[model samples]
Every structure is written in C-alpha cells, then in structure tokens.
Target: MANSLILSYLPRGSVVHKLTGTTKLIVFLLFSVATMVTYDTRVLVVFLVMSLAIFKISRVHYRDVKLILWMAFVFLLLNNLFVYLFKPEYGVEIYQSRTLLVQLIGPYTITAQQLFYHLNMTLKVVVVIPLALVFILCTDPSEFAASLASIGVSYRIGYAVALALRYIPDVQRDYHNINQAQQARGVDISGKDKLMDRLKGSANILLPLILGSLNRIEVISNAMELRGFGKNKRRTWYAKRPFATRDRVVLILGAVIAIGSLIFTFWDGSRYYNPFI
Candidate 1:
C-alpha cells in the first residue's frame, strides 16, 4: 500500500511531464498500436532501446525501471511456458524451417523464429510499459482532469477519471491498514488456517472499506453541490494551463512516429515478420 505503486506523484519538472495529458494519452495509444502491429524483433529492439533512452531523459528512477523489469520477466516466463506447453509443434515447425537456435531436452528445441517471436513480444512490453509508468508517475491528477475537460470530455466524466486515479492509492492504503488491523486482532492470515476461512476473513475486510469509501464520496458530492458545481454551464479550472510550444512539438512528433511506423509496417506486407516466408 505504498501509494507509490499505483501513481508516483513525482515532481513534474521534466519535458515529458509538461505535455498535456490528452497529448500523452494519444501518444500512448499510438505507440501501443504500432508496437503490437510489428513482429520484427530487430525493429522492436530498436524501439525498446529508444523508449529506455526516453525514460532516462525523463529522469525516472532506475529502481522503478528495475521493478518493471522484474514484472516483465514474470510475464516473459509465463508466455514461454504457455507457448512451449500448448504449441510444441510450433517450435518444431519454426526450427525446422528456420535455424535451430538452442537444443533443450532430447527432442525439444528452440528456433531462431521462436526466439525472435518471443523477443519481439518482450520488446513490445519494454517499449510500452515504461511510457505507461512515466505517464502515471509524472502527470498530476488535477491537471489531467482539466486537460480531459478541455478536450470535450464532460466535466462529470473528467472528474470521474481523476477520482479513479486518486482512489487507486487510497484503496491500497486502506487495504494495508485493514490487513494490519486484522493481524493485530490475531486473525491468522498467514498461518495454517483453512483456505475457506482465510478467504472469508479477507472478504469481511471489503465491507468496511467499501462503506468508508462511500461515506467519503457522499461528503465530497455534498460539498460540490453546495458550491454549485454543476449549476454553471461553464466550469473554470484554477489549475488549468495552456499547452506550450514544446508540448505541441511532442504531440506532432508522436503522431509522425505513429504514422510512419504504420506505413512502413503495412508496406512490408507482413503484419508479423516471418523470416521463413
């Protein structure tokens, strides 16, 4: 519940953090789509390296990147396990058609094609994950809401987005507190308790958490209504700031990269690069 996991609330002084939330959102979607559409491992590696460089420039800590890398490793292991177990024939086909990259057990083998496929998938995560983490870490909740509202999102929807982001950290903190309270009360959460009993105990914590959150939300809503929140057709933002020239440049550059990647990928006539083909 170290609220740090969900949203880093880190100081937003970097160039990337200065960009409007709406612009970041667009860039994120475009980059994700481009990464998913390509299967060339070399291209994906290049993209991943570029993304890492951006993370460095943005001043995101190495520790955060390391944590993400651990998660990525877990994801990679799971992916390989599933593929090898369910699609052993795929490995054989790839190795036979391409080149044997590695030979495992008596008959099991890893092929250049299989290696590249997994490498590309891993690199996609490398490119997308850091950008996503940076976005959440650097952007302020209030600024994000203002940006969303400026871009034609209704105030209610924008507020909802902000509230959801805010609630992530709150929920984590609440869960940790509840866990500690239960432990203090001598609830055997980690002992040799029956699985059903442990699950029921965990479920019991949710009731208080949900009720507490509801009470807080009601208070906020009442305050907003008293201040004539929705009565005005036009709402003003105290934290709103106009997007700067650099933000414009970043948005344009992001668009260019997205479009260029799409055009090049399609022109190659292979959504998934298969060297065997």
Candidate 2:
C-alpha cells in the first residue's frame, strides 16, 4: 500500500528479501508473539539485539523507516506518559515492590518499577517493529499472497490481501498527484503556509483522493470479475515457489525461538520476570 510502513515492498537482492514470503511471515509472527508474551528484561534485550541484527542484515537504512520510526516514537512516548499520569504506581503493584525514582506533582510520582515497566514496553515495540518492516518491505505482494495460499489460506483471501498491498502505493501516488494539482491551482498546502492553512489545505485534496480511490476500486473490481476471479473453489498462483532448505531452516528457527522465549520467560510461573524478587 502506497506509503504503508509494513505493507509495501522494495525490490532488492538482499538475503532477507531472498527468503520465501511464507518464511518471513512466519518469522514475523513468531517474534511478535514472543515479544508480546514476555516481560523479562533479559528476554526483551535479547530480542532487541536480534531485531537490530536482522535489520542490519536486511540492509535496511534509517531513511527507509524514518517516518515510521518517528511515528512509533511519538506513539510510545504518549502511551508511556499517559500510563504514568493515570497509573504511575501500576508497576509497583505488579512487581510487588516500590523504589522511588522521583516525587512528581500531586499523584504523579515516578518509581523505578514503573520506569522499568515502561522500558520493557518500549523494548517490546523495538523488538517487533523491525521484523514487521522487513517482512513488508522485502516481500513481493504477489509472492506474499501465493505463500499465504500455499500455507492453506483460501486463495480468495490471499488474492484480496495481495491486491490490498499492491494498491497502497497507487493510492499514495494518487494523493500526491491530486495534491500537486491542487497546489498548481493556487492551493496552499506547502509548508510556507501557516500550520492551520496547511491543515485546511487538506480539504482541497480529500475529495479528489476519495474519488480517485473509488474509481480505482471499481476498475480493479471489474478487471477481477472479467478474469473470472472467485469463480472456482481452487486456484493456482503464478508467483508461488517451492520451499527451499533455507525456508525450512528459518521456519524451524522461528518456532524454536518462540517456544524457547515462552518457556524461559514463564518458567517461574509469572508473565513478568520480577527482577526485584
């Protein structure tokens, strides 16, 4: 999808990109679930390191994820801030200990336990995002759908996903073209305009973007119908590939990592590894 951070692919020859789409998808799922289930600082740190290493191996640059990273940073900061504001002592309750970090205004006091909790939350995000980005940016939409179908998902669902991913860039390109056309017609969407003016200028682009999107959807629907889509219970994929040894290795590794993370993190009968204990 056009400007999507985790649904658009960039064609590359990197090893990460060479992996089968299903394998990448498996890795993404396994790592994401593992990260979500564990609150162990050590586990999170290991995942963080592994994520960074994977990103490096994928040859992903800061520029590739620049906007996504900024958005995630803003979101995480706001989430942490609100958590502290509303439930600053939640960490203490969970960990069954309290160590004051600072005495803030009113009911808003900071504690090491809460900070650690927030740190783990942040680490969880860091550990999952790169995997998602890599899976999205490295996998081709058609190949992804084919891989999905190969994994026993219905071809109809797989085709729908492929189309959705493929259309994101189109929608984005349409938005940009419409914006530029409106700007040429004397709309002030440029940064030189005041913030409010720029915000309001979006009004000029919304109508055209929506109309363009609807028109594109109609065209795609017609084309799909003409091609006899969804007419059969089974379908063959043009982009499907037989799994390679590397694919098997990746899948096995992902499963092992996920299971290992779960076992180790919950070995003490708690979702969180309480360092204070």
CA lDDT, every prediction? 0.74, 0.86
Candidate 2 local Cα displacement, residue 264, angstroms: 1.0
Q: What does candidate 1's lDDT look like per residue over 1-277, in tens digits? A: 3424546556748877777777776677778888888766666776787678777777778664466667777987898778776664473354356577777877567777777666666678778888887777777887778877877888878777787788777876887788789878877566589998888778878888898889988998899899887786668776677778887888799889878877766776665656665
- Spell out the clash pairs found in candidate 1: none
Off by over 4 Å in 2: 1-7
Local distance difference test, candidate 2:
0.86
Model 1 spans with C-alpha error above 4 angstroms: 1-5, 62-73, 83-110, 150-154, 188-204, 221-236
Q: Write the per-residue lDDT of candidate 2 for residues 1-277, one digit (tens) a residue.
A: 3334334588768889889888888788889999999999999999999998888888777777788888889989999888888898999999999998799788888888998899998999988888888888888999999878877899889889888999877777788788778888899787798998888889879887888889989998999999999999998877877789988988898899889999999998998988887
